[model samples]
Target: WKQSHDKDNTNRIKNSTENTSTICVSVCVFLQTILVGDSGVGKTSLLVQFDQGKFIPGSFSATVGIGFTNKVVTLDEVKVKLQIWDTAGQERFRSVTHAYYRDAHALLLLYDITNKSSFDNIRAWLTEIHEYTQSDVVIMLLGNKADMSSERAIRREEGERLAREYSVPFMETSAMTGVNVELAFTAVARELQQRSVQQPSEPRFQIHEYIDAQKEKSSCCRVF
Candidate 1:
């Protein structure tokens, strides 16, 4: 019951599921989601497909430093405005992109199933995420390019195993074919929305507070 349009942000809206729009909803949750991994892992492609409803096919280049777009989604009748950040995956851009992780509530750790190296590098990305986000941050390990079925180097079981080891959720998506694209984003939203429902009386979550709380725990555990 939700769709995305980048160039246009209409004030009025309607939906079969919620019957309300992001612009009109006085009570709505906003989550900052990021897409990160090695370059050419289809992060930008996935965002383009989900945000614009079109695929940018053929030899897509890597993102420069960072890019972002908005998508209004409905999860369990709650309206959510997802600020999805697409980060550059190269080493040089690491410094630039790492700054964006400071406030990310949900992360989309994408890897190319055809590139075993990218699959292997999820650890490095996770390390960076671990440094910036707290335990409350939602991490979803995504094996993208599922449409390249014949060229998959990383099996689904391997991805699942890696996700289990990291205690994160996993899914396979094809930005080219638009497979499971919605689920990838909405699943995270559902979790966030459920947390909000549980703590309806508390103030909206602040990014720094979440980071600081984890930092405090780590400091307390440090051996002096």
Candidate 2:
């Protein structure tokens, strides 16, 4: 009788674990992720490659204000929809870009590997992020255009050192060759998902408010 009772308890525990897993898989989460960088740093191209899986060669008429795209990523059996905004890199649009920072859950800060000035300006961008976004915002530093090895101005070690100084994750990506583009976004999404699960009661920005505000400004671009 004792052995039979033990087996019954084990079966019940297994069933309970399965039920918990099922609940976790059913969870759907939305995360507001944004990309910020200097103009000509390939921020838009990175977003395009991640969303559409293709690279647009040559120059893209720099995003004037802000444009966004949505992609669903699954992390730990949870569905996370990433609302990724591509902010204008030009100085004139800094204010416009800053306004969206408060509600962002994660940010990808990019700098051109071939441009030393762009890398140098990372401090300014980090300052703005601290000023505008919440303290817990997840940020990743990316050195883009890794494919241009011969023209590389920023060494990989330098990127790693800067990231360590700021205490943020760092990676080198090539939007032209689609290297680590997907991984970069996925890494951000995974972190966001984990944070949401851990802080279930955290106050969240209403999606409706974002939609209403976007309607007022027709400059927002939606890629799909």
TM-score of each: 0.77, 0.76
lDDT, model 2, position 114 = 95
Give lDDT tens digits, candidate 2, residues 26-119.
Answer: 5487778999999999999999999999998985989976777767777767777777889899998887778789989999999999999999
Error of 1 at 186 (Å): 0.3
- Name the top lDDT candidate: 2
Once model 2 is optimally superposed onto the true structure by TM-score, how far is the C-alpha of residue 2 displaced, in angstroms?
77
lDDT of each: 0.77, 0.81
Error of 1 at 91 (Å): 0.5
Candidate 1: global Cα-lDDT?
0.77
lDDT of 1 by residue, 114-194 (tens): 999999999988998999887788898989999897999999999989987988877788898777677678777877876
List the pairs of residues colliding in candidate 1: none
